[model samples]
Target: MPCRDLPPPPPPAHLRGWLDEAVVRADRARFLSDLGRRSLGVGRLLLLWAVAAVFVLGWSFIGMAWMAFEQHDPFGYVYGLILAVLGAGVLIPAGFWVARGARRDRQVRHLLHAWGESDRDPVADARVRAPGRSLTWLVTSLVLGAFGLWVAFAAAVSARPGDTTYGEVAYTMGIGQILWITGLLGLAKAAAHYRWAVRTFRAPAP
Candidate 1:
């Protein structure tokens, strides 16, 4: 008689159920892991933006102070100096905070990547957490951008060529430009995060 071939048997019932459960758990873990990674990425971007804002604003104020002093405008010089001091105050603390956060983020990212590659469950891991909706960030960005635009427009409208030097106009415009650009970028990031969250974390139907 010719040799007969038989199909392999399916998994045992209990084993099949357990296997399906494992798959579900693993899928959830991977989702959480990816979410955590994205959150960290946003955080890093915000931190970088903070550094840039501090650097640009601080220098802008200092440059304005110098220009105003050269022009012998007492009010402008004093105003500029006050702003410069305020900028320095913010920059000092922000610098340290950003550096620490950057280091921590790098460490967390490494851990999450390793956990994912190893098929470890990120849900069980406390380090993995979901990000917020980012509404606050979005609103703040819009407000700052609006305020900057208003300031820039007002400065441009009020200053006459005879009364204002090129340096004065340039410095005044620079502050507003920096603020609006930073705010616009922040708004984009916040909106992106919000959209991602909405898409990824849809509510389950009752």
Candidate 2:
């Protein structure tokens, strides 16, 4: 058999470097876009869960109240009524906000899809940070934490040995702890965002 000549060597290092960088940028952009989409999906699911909880728990309380009324049990009626009222108070606004957020997330996802196709710099744009968004979350966490603390205090004051309010008191304390932990997490997130923004802003221009 006749011997065949070998093919020429590969492209130069500089050209290969450029190709590698291009591929990396493309991958990064896709990753950021996918992350944004997943985050939005999770947010929507959480909102839906909240809505379901509000309705289901609220209706359950109201049903209990109705049964108590039929039995002429004043304490049970009042307890259920109070819980039903609290549930109702949280439900209406949460339902509306979830609806709006779902619609907005859908629109943003559409925009993200379009941008990912056309923009080479999609990673930067896909960050999706509002100027004061972190601050807003921090403030909300503070308010919730404070409210939870107050509730816990009240529960502690009302708690007694072999009392009917023991379960309520324990529940309130648990809620307070959860709220405090949530607030701390929010604070940490806000601080991280602040540090990142500062670093990015102060860095020298490329």
Candidate 3:
């Protein structure tokens, strides 16, 4: 007589438990990795902005330096006139650029916090390490940007070649300074948010 085939056996008890735990960890890991990407994304954007700010500041500096070598007061009068036009046009726009980056960084910080505040808290197991590198860049930007602004102010008010020259150099300097500050502020805000995320996640659960 043909015997009926035995039913397939259930998985071993210990193996089943271990498998479930592994699955949980794996799922959490994937989720945390995504979150980390988001956290770092803001930093990357700030970095791009920082580059642009530096470029503008550098180019303006080059223009200011040219005036020093020419030493032709009339040429300076023309330079001052050109700078006044650019100061109002370009410098004003740079302020908005900074505000834009800061706004984006602010929104990102909120998103980072919301991730852990979810009702289920399934991804709490993910750990965040100290963001020393990000912090360094941020602080550097702040200090440098501030110094740049001061330099611009000094240049603008400095003795000019003619009556109309006014503070042409100073105006140009101010624009460069503002550009740097905006980048710095954006980076600093992002670093602060990242630090908070890491600390909050690592803290003992309520």
Winner by lDDT? 1
How does residue 206 of candidate 3 score in lDDT? 85
The C-alpha lDDT values of all candidates are: 0.59, 0.51, 0.53
Q: In terms of lDDT, which candidate is stronger, 1 or 2?
A: 1
Report the lDDT of model 3 for residue 19: 64
State how far residue 37 of model 1 sits from its true place (Å): 9.0
Of candidate 3, the 10-residue stretch with the lowest lDDT total is 1-10
What TM-score would every model get versus the actual structure?
0.49, 0.42, 0.49
Q: Can you tell me which runs of candidate 1 are displaced by over 4 Å?
A: 1-49, 65-133, 203-206
Model 3 lDDT, residue 161, Cα: 72
RMSD (Å) per prediction = 14.3, 14.3, 13.8
> With candidate 3 superimposed using the best TM-score fit, by how many Å does residue 146's alpha carbon deviate from the native?
4.0
Across 1-206, the per-residue lDDT of candidate 1 in tens digits comes to: 10232122233446656667676456546555554645434554566466657856665766566676666777877876787687677667766876765565444444444433433343444434344435556776788788778777877887897787766776777778767876786687567555544443444459
How far residue 159's Cα lies from its native spot in candidate 1, in Å, is 0.9
Clashing pairs in model 2, backbone N/Cα/C closer than 3 A:
none
lDDT of 3: 0.53
